[model samples]
Structure formats: C-alpha cells, structure tokens
Target: MKAEKNAVLTGAHFIDGDHAACEGAIAAGCKFVAGYPITPSTEVIERIALRFPLVGGVFIQMEDEIASSIAIQGAVWAGKKAMTVTSGPGFSLMMEHIGYAAITETPCVFINVQRSGPSTGLPTLPAQADMMQARWGSHGDYEVIAIVPNSPQECFDLTIRAFNLAEEYRVPVLVMMDECVGHMTEKVVIPEADQIDIVERKFTKKPPGEYKMFETNESMVPEMIKVGDGYRMHLTGLTHDERGYPAMSPKVQQKMLRRLVDKILLNEEKIRHIEEDEVEGADIVVISYGITSRVVLPAIKKAREDGLKVGHIRLLTVWPFPEAYIRDLAKRVSAFVVPELNLGQIVHEVERCAAGHAVTRLVPHAGGAVHEPVDIYDAIKGVLEHA
Candidate 1:
C-alpha cells in the first residue's frame, strides 16, 4: 500500500529526530497517538498533537504511560494505525501492555527515546541501556521487532519502517531512539506519498459467522477484523485458541505461545537488517547501533589507518539480533568489539553468536555520556594485538 497523500509532508525539512519520527508515523498512515509527555521524547507527540488534527487523526495525552500504551492497542483493534512515544521510565510502565500486544497479535508502534537509567536516571541525557529491555522486558516467550536510528534522517525513515513491520508481522514494533538521535537535527527529505510503500493491516475477508480472530494461514500471522465491523473478536493476554478465547490448558498454551515466538524466529532472515563494511577479510569487527554507531566511526577509521583491519557492522534492526550473519562473520574475524552507552547488553548477543570461534570485547559505558573514540580505538587495537 502507498501512503496517504495529505499525510505525507513531501518536502525537505530540517528537524529534530523526535519531530521527524512524528512526521514518519503520519506518513506511514498512523492515525492515532496516545502518550504522556516524557523528556527527550515529548517533541514526537507534541508535533503529533498539532499535525494529527490537520490530517484528520487523533492525538491524546493519556493519564500516564500505562494508559498511553494500552490505548494505542484499542485504536489498533478499532481499525486505525496507532503509536505511542516515551522514554525509559515510561517505557518500563508499558511492558505489560507490550506483552499483551504480543499475545493478542496487535500491530502497533512504540517510539522509545531511551534515556539514562534503571529509574528516572538521566531524563535529559542519552543512553542505549534499553537495548535489552526493548526485546525482553515484557517477559514470556514472545518476539518483537526493534529498529534503531542513529540520526534524524534515519529517525524519519525507520519510524515508517517500524509501522510497516508491525502491520506485516502482527507484532509490536519498537523504534529504539537514544536521546542523541531523538534530539539531533538534520535535513530529512520526505518523498511524495506515491513514492513510499506501506503495508496496510491484513483484514480478513471471511464473513462474520465464519471468522475466527486468531486463525492463521501459512505465514503464522493471523488476519484481523475491525471492532464494530460486524465481526466478533476476542483479544486477551492469556493463552488463546484460534477463536481468540482463553483455553486455560497446557496444550493451548504450547500451541499459541509457540506460534507467537516461531513466526518471528522462523522468518528471521526477512526481518533482520544489518549494515556491514569491510568485513569480508578483517581481523576485528566493531559492532554498534543507534548513537554509538556514529560515535565509534572515528575509532574504526583510526584503527584502519594504523593498519589494523577493523570492519564495522551497524545493526539497523537490533532485535532478532542478526545471529546468523554475526555467526558467519565470526568465523572469518578474530574478534568482535562492541561499544554501547550502557554497561554491556548487545555485546552478550555478539559473544553468543561468535560461539567460541572469535573473541568478543566490550567497551562499556555507564549512562550519562557517550564513549570516547580513543576508548573504542584502544579496544580495537587491544583485540588485534592480542590475536
């Protein structure tokens, strides 16, 4: 599907990543937004509140993060594309609903502009600490698609991608933007509506009497029906049968939960997006995402100038973790150096994927600031010197 004409801005604009993300959501046919303002992420909904009205959409500031999270799911079931924006604390509050969205197969976007913290740590600063939480915070054995943006332009581009993935997979999609990317201002060119591709919600054509909400085809993704559209739909976080009713049995639990996990795991190749540079023949690969990807570029450059073959891999979609690619690359590379704003999260995934074939080095940072290029360069050199 193509984007709506009126919803596409269709021009060049210099804007912050948060505002760019809002424009992307609108361009992607997101008609409803429910969120409470949170630092470094508030501008997304602030722009939505003003722009949604012009495009015949709705934006509501719910009482809190929990309300905001669940409200978008209601809008989604009512046949509207929906999203919510928040930072760390608010993101934590939304975990239960995230799991609900997973179990019920709700297609929605969550824009989490990550801040420093376990709890309200650094409201205005940047951190990539939520990398692990975005995938595993909700609990249980469900899967989600997570995309990270390193700049304002990518913030605009990937926000639209997030909604499309949500619609395509019938799972919650997270746009993991750190405070640096969320607030960074740059030129973003939004093409005409026709120039963009969109994935509309997959609604069932079966008659009301014949329809079952959780019935699936070969793809393992179930078709949806709009609420109040003459079709009966039942949705819950509990283990459900094909008809969407709680079955409360171990058999039903295995069947339903496994599908939720397998649909993503089975189709991992289709969902994974990683950018690799100079990795074909290199001794060390520096892996990073979001803001940290940009920060580590100079270090990678210096390592190369110093004659150490340092490859670079930027994870565009962090979740579903590109394990196969990393596993394959590990066989050729001697070590993988991972740097993050958090202490160490994604590096663990790298270690697992490397699987004893290669060494995994972490350049960890606490929340408040980004890593120095020297720190990353030293890690790269140290890895190579040891090898």
Candidate 2:
C-alpha cells in the first residue's frame, strides 16, 4: 500500500472510535480481516470491508465466528498480516480455533472488543470481564499475549503492537478492548511511515526443498514459509515436530509442546509491560488495567491529595501477567487493591504476587456500568487505614 500524502492526519478525521481502530490496522500493514458482525466490534469489519478493496487487501465476512477465526488462520498461513475482531459471544465461538492458532504456532492477531458476558450479559456495554478469559479462554496451558488498551489512541497503538508480538513470538496475540475505548473517539497521532517500526514475519531465504517449517535457531522464532511457496510444508492442530508434521509419539509431542510454551514463557522480560505511578513510597498500591485503570487514576489522585500513601499500577500487557513486577511491588507496599469490572479475575493474580507481605482486596463491579472513582478511593482508604 502506498503511503497517503496526508495520512499522518488520517486518524484525526476518524471521529468514530471503531473506525479509528480499523484505520490503525490498515496503517499497520494488516492485509486481511475475517470476522462475523457483532455489536461494538461490527464497525471494525464494516470499515475494513470498505477500505481493504482499495488497498488490494482481502476482507471476508464469514457466516459465523467459527468460520471467521478459521479464515484468519488460513490468511496467516497464506503469509499475510491477518486478524478477526469480535465481542463476547463471537469470541466464545472462536475459542477452539484460538487453540488451533496456539498449537500450529500461527502468527495472527485476535481483537476482542469486549462487551459484558458470562454468556452475552450485555452486548453493547463496556466490561473488563474478559480479562481472565483472554488468558484462559482457548483451553489448555498454552501461553499467549493479551494487551488491554484504555483509549482510542491505545486501541490504535496496541493493535499494531499486538501484530508485532504475534509475528515475533509465533503465537496468537489478543488485543482486549472494552466498549468504553472501542466506542470513544479522541485525537490519535498516526506515525509517519519512516517513523514507525513494523516487524514482518521472518521468512526463510532458503530454497523450497531446504526449508524447515518449525526449525528454531537462537531467536526461537522459526522462519515461516507460506502454504503455496512450494515448500511442501505441513500444518496441523495436533502436536507437531519441527517439520510441521504430526508427532504422535509421546516424546516428540512433549518436546514440541514444551518448546511452544517455553518460547514465550521463558521470555518473560520481553513480554511483560506495565505503568507505575507513585509506587516508591506507597503503603497501598492500587492495581488496575484496561478501562478500569482510567477510573482508578482519579482515585489515586484523590488518595494522594488526602495524604494517603497510595499508588497505582496499570498493566499494558495483561497476559503473561506481569508477575515479576507485581511481586516486586508486593514486597514494598503494605497492601494491594485491584479494581475491575469482574468480581475477582485480576485480584487473584495480585494476591498470588502479594503473598504474605501485603493484603490484597478486590473492588469489583460487573456489566451495568463502570466503577466510579469514589468507590475505588474508598477501597484504597479502607485498605490503608486498616492494614
């Protein structure tokens, strides 16, 4: 795609939040989008369908979420930057394919613009209820990356980062966007082409007969060869060896699965991302992410003004869950308070990290509306005065 002359200002003109995310995906070199229409996330597909044809990219509206996810995997195998966007219900339908992406080590992005749910609790309301689901939704013990963006700019920036991480790790990366960020518009500065850092899938320059599909060198990211590249590569959802052939033998399966998990799990330093504020001297640390972090910020400010030793930690990458950072903060702070749209998804992680050093509290609010700043402020005040 040729760079538009005034493309730097393109995001500025996209007033609709979803359209901004759609334009961001295109600007970030996404060539294929396959998804079913769902509330909140539907606009992403609609926008892509309209613009992709002009850029020589492909856009397919599948009959269902299952087919949409399957099509995305196929597009990725065809060596394009491909993605599927969905809400809670659609995401439920795509779980099996998500596991398929995991086992095949397919590099692709899945955008879940989350709406309320255990099972379609609220189709159009914002909720961070999917936090745990994003990590454990697919089934099995596979490690994956899930990022939460709090605003439209982050929805744009993190979507691009999600693609980069997927290609680098050869794993499915999920961008968790709540209805709040996915539907709200704000000024987003899209970087110029020369200023942007884009990572393409690493491809082998070796001749067709010489290439190995899953052979890993020092980087642990194997050189990807496309399906029709005359490489004779094989891919399957079953456990497979370096050649991409199914390895039914117990030992081969063990080796392949271990490597797949280790490739991301062992590289914790590279995958973990968070933002810390006033944490150094704090006695109570408030932990939050996604849209909940937006609400928590004002509470943190209020606590500070009230002369409470309160601080905040906002996670940029929610999965591969910033355990190390949380653990470190745990040793220093007197207590930890986690506020989310769900009852206790992330609070458990904070509790695990805090262990014996600090007390952990859950300030949860479900689907109907966001937790007000005062609710979080009271939680922090209570934890501090009582701990």
Candidate 3:
C-alpha cells in the first residue's frame, strides 16, 4: 500500500536517528504516540509532537512510562497505529504492559534508545545492553521482532518496517536502538509515497455475531475487530479460547501458548534476515548488531587485509534468534565471535545454536560506550590463530 500523502516526508534531509525514526513513523501511517521522554529518546517524540498533528496524528506525553506503555494499546484497538519511545529505566516500567499486549494480541511498536547500566548508569552514553531485555524483559512464553539500525538512513527505513511487522504478526515490535544511533546525524532519504509498501491491520470481515476475536486462519495471526464496530468481543491476559473468553484448562493453555510461539517460529522463513559476507569458506564469523556492527567494520576490513578469512553477519532482526542460519553456519566455521555492549547476552544464543559443533567466543563490555575497533580485531585475530 502507498503511504498516506500527508504523513509522508518525501525528501532528503540530514538528521539524527531519533528524528529520522519519527519521520519513518509518520511515513508508515503511525498516527498516535504516547511516551515519557527520557534522555537520547526524547528527540523522537520531540519531532513527533511537532509533525504528528500536521499529519492528523496524536501525540500524548503521559504522566509516566507505565501510562505511556499501555496508552498505545488503547489507540491500536481503536484502529490506529500507535507507539511509545523510552530508555532503560522506562523500559523496565513498561514490562507488564508488554506482556499484556502479547496475550491480548495488540499490534504496536516500542522504541528503546538503549543507555548503559542496571539502574541509570549513563543517560547520555551508548550501549546495546538491552538486547536480552528486549527479548525476555517481559515474563512469559512469547516472541517479539526487534531490528537494529546502524545509521540514520536505516533508522528511517527500519522504523517503518517495525510497524509493518507489528501489524503483520499482531505483536509488540521493538526498535532496539542505542544512544549513539539515536543521536548520530547523517543524510536520510525518504522515498516518494508510491514507493513505500505498507501492511495495514487485517480487520475481520465477519459480522458482529460471527466475529470471534481470537480466531485465526493460516497465518496464525487473527484478524482484528475494533471495539465499537458492533462486534461482541472479550480480550483477556489469561488463557483464552477462540471466542476470546477466559479458559483455564491445561488443554486451552497449551493450545493458546503454542500458537503464540509457533506463529513466529514456523513462519521464520518470512522473517529471517542477516547480512553475511565471505562465509562460504571463512573460518571465523563475527556476529554483531546495532552500534557494535558499525564499530566492527573497520576490524573486518583489517582482518581481510591481513589475509584472515573472516566473514561478517550483521543482524537486522534480533529476535526469533535466526536459528536456522546460525545452526548451519556453525557447522562450517571454525569459531563464532559474538560481541555486544553487554557482558554476554546474545552470545549465549550464538552458543546455543552452535551447540558444541563449533567454538563460540565472546567479546564482552559493561556498556556506557561501544568497543574500539582494535578490541574486536584482537578477539577475531585470537580465534583465527587457534583455528
């Protein structure tokens, strides 16, 4: 579908990642934003507050992050694409609502401009530490699609994709941004409206009496029905049946829970994304994402120059784990080097997929900043030497 004309900012502009993301949201037809501005992420809503109204959108800065988190769901149920922006401290506050969105199948987006620390470590610094939290921050068995952008251009491009995926799967999608990417300025070219492809919510064609809210077809994503559309609906966080009513039997729990996960895993082919280079015969494959991917580029070039056959896999979508690709690649590579802003989050995932078939080494950091190219270079060098 083409973008809504009023919402499309079809032009080139030099801007920061936060502002680029805001424009992407506008272009993707996201008309409502509810957020409590935190450092690094405040600029996203700052731009939205100014642009949303012009595009017939709504911008609400709620009293706190919890209010901001749940507010977007309300807008989504009312037939609007909605989102909330936040940082570490605020993201923790929003966990309960994230779970609520999952069980109730609310299609919404959340932008997390990650900062460093367990509790307010560095408001102005950068870190990719929230990766694990983004995957498992909410308690329960569910899946989320997360994408990381290394530049302002992708920041603009992928924010639109995030909303599309949310609507496609009826789950909360996360734009896992870092403070560096959020603040870094670069040229972002947004294309004309006709060039943009969008996926709108699939509203049910069934009449009021026939529309069962949680019923699904082949895609496992149930067609949604608006609350005031004269449809009889009941949505709950507890185990629910096809009619959306509370059902507590073990059989009901297994059916509902499995569908929630299987929808993503079984359909993983549609969602698998990774930028791989020279992995055909390379011994060491470096896996990284977000700001860390950017930093690792220089090191990759250096490795190539030294005649070390090093390949690169840059993760665009971090969730659902990209299990198939990693599992296959692990068999051929001598070792997999995993690095991130956290001490060791995604590395465990790499190890799990590799499953003792190959060596998986970690390059750890405690956040507040990114790694130096040399630090990553040395890690890659050591692994290849042992190989």
For residues 251-288, what per-residue lDDT tens digits would candidate 2 score against the true structure? 98788878778888788779888888888998898988
Candidate lDDT values, in order: 0.93, 0.84, 0.90
The predicted structure with the larger TM-score, 2 or 3, is: 3
Instruction: Please provide the root mean square deviation of candidate 1 (C-alpha atoms, Å).
Output: 0.8
Listed in order, each prediction's TM-score against the native is 0.99, 0.96, 0.98
* Range of the 10 consecutive residues with the lowest summed lDDT in candidate 2: 1-10
Best by lDDT: 1
Predictions ranked by TM-score, top down? 1, 3, 2
Count backbone overlaps in model 3. 0
For model 3, residues 136-161, the per-residue Cα lDDT tens digits are 89998888888999888888899999
Q: Clashing residue pairs in candidate 2, if any?
A: none
| Candidate numbers sorted by lDDT from highest down | 1, 3, 2
